[model samples]
Target: MLHNKVEEVKSREDLIKFLLHLRKDLQTKGNAWENITLKDYLEAMEAWVEDMDGYYLNTNQPIPKQPSWKTIADILYAATMYE
Candidate 1:
């Protein structure tokens, strides 16, 4: 059910780096997240979840199409941690 491809990460460091940037992006955006556009939302979500590519990152599971409404809500829930 993994959404992401089977491509192995280049290294754990990369994963760590990706997560750091993701956290930073969310942190900087802060309350400004609401003003972001759909395209920006996609980009932010992708980067946060390792560029999801074709799947959701949280569970590393493939989504039927993009993601569900709950999915977005969950993302925001977790993302709020950056605040």
Candidate 2:
């Protein structure tokens, strides 16, 4: 379900929908999420961006040189719970 949402994010509107899905997920399963507060989410986002290349390398995916809609959505979705 979440994977489908990630793949569906092609436009700004789709990005917004994915964000809403994140919100809903957090509301329903926040205890499982790492970053719940706004401060935590912001800090996690910064850290994630700093180490994004490592993430790609570890995942065996090519590093993205440009920011696409999916990349933006991935960052936002990760920031919600990424440690």
Candidate 3:
């Protein structure tokens, strides 16, 4: 089930849609927001850094001097999901 959901994210647009769905799910389920803390916010930033590192290692691409706003938004959404 998880794999299928993951497989659906074939592009950045799909990912944004999925994250929006996840955000809605989290909201409807309740307490997801309540459970988040300052630490969680920091952890989300850490997750972004880790993700960037992994991307660099796996793709052999240098980090962009200026990451796109969409990329930053995606990272923040992912971090929130972790919380």
Q: Model 3: which residue pairs collide?
A: none
Ordered list by TM-score, greatest first? 2, 3, 1
lDDT, candidate 1, 1-83, per-residue tens = 11121122235554454445545666676565542555656556556455443335456766536554444444433333322
Itemize residue pairs with steric clashes in candidate 1. Answer: 2-62, 3-61, 3-62
Please tell me which predicted candidate would have the highest TM-score against the true structure.
2
lDDT of 2 by residue, 10-61 (tens): 9999998998998898889888888998999999999899888887799888
Q: Considering TM-score, which of the candidate structures 1 and 3 is the better prediction for this target?
A: 3
**Model 3 accuracy (lDDT, Cα):** 0.57
TM-score attained by model 1 = 0.29
Candidate 1, lDDT over the whole model: 0.45
Q: Residue-wise lDDT of candidate 3 within 1-83, one digit each (tens)? A: 22234446656786676667655655676365533566876687677667676655675766756655444554555565553
Candidate 3 wrong stretches, greater than 4 Å: 1-25, 29-35, 56-62, 81-83
RMSD after CA superposition, every candidate: 11.5, 1.5, 5.4
